[model samples]
Target: MESSSNFTPFLLFLSATLTVLSSVSANSEGDALYALKRSFSDPDNVLQSWDPTLVSPCTWFHVTCNQNNRVTRLDLGNSNLSGHLVPELEKLEHLQYLELYKNNIQGVIPPELGNLKNLVSLDLYNNNISGIIPPSLGNLKNLVFLRLNDNRLTGPIPKELVGPPNLKVVDVSNNDLCGTIPTTGPFEHIPLNNFENNPRLEGPELLGLVPYATNCS
Candidate 1:
């Protein structure tokens, strides 16, 4: 009878251990989502519905998760969110789509965003962000679509972004940028509209014109 009593406590210990392990796994997912939530300062409470108490981000609005319960899509475009882009977003290892266009976010593009190796589409256009494009963004090897138009970003276009192998669409117009646009690879195929309004920018063909030739010289 005494031996049975000892075995009962052993079983209880095993059950408790399993429970703790399960809780840890659950909290880890919550922690990642929570970190992303905390990065943005939602002034109009657009993201107030993103509560940690929710069992999974999959059930949350505007957040799509894969079968494994990992967040893969974050589409919050035109949600009126106003804040700076946070480097903490790199924690979403499985994120594939991130859309936050038509907002008021303002700041330098965080180089750490390159850590999202699985990212395929990133759209942050029509914002107030101001900064030079980070060369580290060239590391998004899987990026297919990237848009950052109508912003306050300044400086020369990073040459590294000219011809990323997987890149198909890139828009960086209406910004305060300058320099001779690269004439190789993707740059050669992009239309004049893509680099318009940046008065200092000179394309290969444009450089031969009398007006452009004088400025470029």
Candidate 2:
């Protein structure tokens, strides 16, 4: 009888521990996003609703959450937001879509974005963003659509972003990207026109030839 009572206390403690851990995990993501909100210059007051004191970021504008209240999407496209992206965004572990297209947001792609293993679509096209595509983005095995077109980005396309298992669409066109195009994995199926307008970018690299390291810098 005493052992049974002890077991009940243990069970309660374990449950409480799990609950606290889950809450902390969810809050961590919220904190990361709030950091992003603080980094931007929101000309449209689009991010004014992002109050950190909220129980969760699910209540914020341009943010979406899963059934578990974990952040899953951020739809801030065309919001006229400027300023650089924060590396703190890497904390959004469950993020699937990051849509910041058509904004004036400028700066380099955060290599920490590779930490978002659950990402599906990444659309930052039509912005003034510059800097080389991070090789770390290759870690997003779940990535499907990657559109960074019409930017001021320079340097060779990182070969790391070529072979995501679910990739379907990639449009880096109209950028200042250099080096030979990757012709492996998902790259083999992307249409040539999608890569058009990059003056220095070369071939869907040939069969046996050693592809450019794309690290010309």
Candidate 3:
């Protein structure tokens, strides 16, 4: 009779331990999402709808989650969010879609964004962001869509950006960027509009045909 009583207590203890471990794992994932949420400055309260107090980010509007309940998509396009791209966003390791197009965000693209290895689509077009495109973005091997058009960015387009094998759409028009456009990968098939409005840019065809003081060859 005494052995049965001891066995019952042991089973109860094991069950409690398993429950606590599951809760901790869920809390850890939630904390990671909360940290990224705190990075952005939502002036117009577009992201005000994102409440971390909720059980999971999956329940938040505009945020999509996977079967594991991890944040996978953040579509905030045309929401009028005005702020700098925060490096802390790298915390969302499972993020696949990050759409922030047609906003008023300013400042340089954060290099830390390269940490998102699973990212597939990153659209940040029609913003007022400036500065050079970070070469570190080449780390996203699964990226298919990347749009950075209609911004005030300057400097050379990183040749490293052409390394993504799955890259399909890349629009970087209407920027202040200068220098030669990459002649490899998806760049070779890109339309002329992709390189338009950048006064100092020299396309592949004009690289050797044009005669100028800059020596584009």
Winning candidate number (lDDT): 2
Where in model 3 is the C-alpha error above 4 Å? 1-44, 205-217
lDDT per model vs. reference: 0.76, 0.89, 0.80
Query: Which sequence of candidate numbers ranks them by TM-score, best first?
Result: 2, 3, 1
| Stretches of model 2 off by over 4 angstroms after superposition | 210-217
What are the models' TM-scores? Answer: 0.77, 0.94, 0.80
Tens-place lDDT per residue, model 1, 109-197, is 88888888889998989999998888777888888888989888877777777646777777888887766666555666666687777
Query: lDDT per residue, candidate 2, 1-217, as tens digits?
Result: 9999989999999999988877887789889999888889997799999988876889998899998788899999999899889899999999999999999888899999999999999999999989999989899999999999999988887888776989999999999888888888898899999989988887777774855845355
* lDDT score for candidate 3 against the true structure: 0.80
For candidate 1, give the lDDT: 0.76
RMSD of 2: 1.7
RMSD of each: 6.3, 1.7, 4.8
Residue by residue across 1-217, what tens digits does model 3's lDDT show?
9999999999999999977765565455566656645766677776666676766667777889887677788898998677777776786788999999998889999998899999999999999999988988888999999999999988877878889889888888998877777767877778878879988777653544533213221
Q: Write down the worst ten-residue block by lDDT for model 1.
A: 208-217
